[model samples]
Target: MAKKKSPPETLLLLPKWPSSAPIVDTHTHLASTFEAYRTRYKDHATVFDMVRAFYHNTTVEALVDVWCEAPVRTVWREFADSALTPEDRTLKWGGIDYWFVMGVHPHEAQHYTDDIENDIIAAMSHPRCVGWGEMGLDYHYDNSPRDIQRSVFRRQLVHAVKLGKPLTIHTREADDDTELILKDLVPKDHKIHIHCFTDSPEFAQRLLDYFPNLYIGITGVITYATNTDTSTVIKNMIPSSLRILLETDAPFMVPANLYNSIPELKGKRLPISHSAMIPWTADFVAGLTEGKWDAERVMIEARENAKRVYGI
Candidate 1:
């Protein structure tokens, strides 16, 4: 019989925010892990895997889950239930308190229909739904035609404005068009955030000038030494912590520091990203600010900004 190989050592050197850090991951996708598990290992994936996948939530005080596409009914139900149930056991499990935003992603803009709109509107009535979006243009992919993406985004913007909810925006490579749409459709006083902001410093300045309450969402991508554009803007342009929101964009932009440094997570079929990675991001942001802002200060400001914008 072949001898069983010992498990590879997983590095645990990534920074951990204190339990009292008041951290709020302002944007993330929650259903990816379960969905992947269901698709690949439906028979073998146990409840334990689901729990382990979500065990990342232990790192943050609260989270803003973004539903960019229509989630299966059960996932939506579970999210709503988590928001309503607040027992100590749940809390001990690193039960993250949550608020959500829903909208059509630019890649899926062509698939948008009245039914989808109505479904989103109806979901807004759920006690946990607090904003509208993850919607905007993706000139890079152009998965949906530019015109169609713009039209779908505008319709959602109108609905969000009328509904009195904040906007969770997604703009990439089409900064001018995104700025034009926001200028034309969104109200000046409305709460708007550029989630996973990777735009130019000039564009950041333009939006900051145009929208008094606009906030920029920062994610673990900041940990990458190659991502100079965002790092430069964070370092030189955005001086005030008040205009920033910390996010994982998870199951997506797992930080370089966390991704490359972690030992146990190595040799995975795919890299896993989670809200628990936000502290690594917070630490990175502190370094970018040259200690002008520490991890605690960044987390505190982000929490307050999330509360004010999302009305949680």
Candidate 2:
């Protein structure tokens, strides 16, 4: 019998972005990323420690970390408070500007309650809190009943719209309902982000046509072999007219290209993704553009779009 070969050693290398342009990861889960790192290394590491290790040499200027839990993590206060000033951010987060968005995810829609909403509402007043969301429909899992998802989604939308905050949405396998609710509740000119979009190009076009300020959040998922929708959307849309934002959705979609770029990585996968990985996602997006754009252009455009949508 042939001996089973051992798997290639897993490696995590920082992206070689090839440019000095600063990038902002418009959507990520920082605390979740920290937790993933802690789990992988089995060390009692601080978020600051993770930041220093992963982001020291990268051109990651800022990140919009997400907080979409039901009861709202208490540590959110620590994260938000730390980003209140430049001095504080420099000291705690390695000078990476930290902004956050708060909401209850569609998966947690069943756990939505009045008190929980109050906490999210109060977070909107925090200077470091840039938006409200990641709240939308997720029929793919249907972790919560569809009706409950819709109710909680709309309730959160009402609060976010009333507060005049930007939106970071999460929609999957429920494009029709997501579209209906968004069109019905959200203003046409509202700053909206369809985070980690993997829906069809037609749906993307419709949303783009309706919402002038809405930008599609692209992640490392675009580099996957199994995904064509994301690349199709990039190809069909004119690069000059691209309304897209680069995000990692970190601790989730580590760009598949990372594995291919480094010889030592072989078939191993990174345990977590972070803001510094935006350039890899940008590089993949550039490939989809058929030479019309490059990694640096993608980074610059995404940074501009992040400012337009989140004002960060």
Candidate 3:
């Protein structure tokens, strides 16, 4: 008798989830993840294959793939054709419709120039580009001087406002300045999201009160046992209905619980995260809701919320 074939190695590495739960990953870095996967998987991996593998267990149907530093042209060339187009309209991520956000991150503030601004202006004309960001302050790293970071962020904010597109912000130790600039510049009618929010409840409340269209994006950070603050903010501060959304911020914040489950990645120097693990984060949110909200309800509303804010 012929020997039976073994299952694909990917099966063992992925987390299990209920297929009935549909999720939309509101923010991700698929371009960076694509590069990482290409290097690791070599000739064997395509983005389609990566999506297929990701969809096997989780119910993530759509994702907004964001780029912080790379030019919008590069982002579009990599994902728009294979990933952004929808296989079906109703399903959203059912066939995983993809979208993108473009901006210069604070880290690259030193490089921000007229040429960069022009590139962003030209990119705004693209149909698939729905939002502007992964931009804001990061005083902790201060990778770029504080003055430069503020200037670059304000420049992008001006363009994003002019374009009538939503803004995705990344604020760290520089919350005070972030709030000041945003409050002064971005109109209350325009949408803004604080992506990967790990700030205090006071900060969350301040932003929500200041920006009528502001939304909080929860990532895999809440899944880490050490991240009680994020979970607390989600449970008490953020509105459960439509003002919140889910994201992976992939190739960065993998769900801590799921990360621990994989044996091979336990001691690895660096592990990879992708949009596929959204269900893990969603489940964590459901738990934080404490029977007040279920995973499906949260995911569905978040999907609609993303659609509204991102204009997808």
Model number with the top lDDT: 2
lDDT of 1 by residue, 244-296 (tens): 88898866877776555445655542344666777778777877787688777
- TM-score list, all predictions: 0.85, 0.95, 0.86
Q: Against the hidden true structure, what lDDT does model 1 obtain? A: 0.75
What TM-score does structure 2 among the candidates reach? 0.95
For residues 1-312, write the lDDT of model 3, one tens digit per residue.
984343334633476665566677888887677676665554436566666655655666677877778343464644654443445322323366677778888988888889878877776776677888889999988999999999889999999999898999999878789999998889987898899988777888888887878889999888877777778777774344647888888778878766555666544423457766776777778887777777777778778888779876
Give the runs in model 1 whose Cα sits over 4 Å from its true position: 1-19, 36-59, 70-74, 88-94, 237-239, 259-270
Each prediction's RMSD to truth? 4.3, 2.8, 5.4
- Predictions in order: lDDT: 0.75, 0.88, 0.75
Error of 3 at 53 (Å): 2.8
Deviating ranges (above 4 Å) for candidate 3: 1-16, 56-58, 70-75, 81-94, 238-242, 259-270
Task: State the weakest 10-residue window (summed lDDT) of model 3.
Answer: 85-94
Q: Which ten residues in a row have the lowest lDDT in candidate 2?
A: 4-13
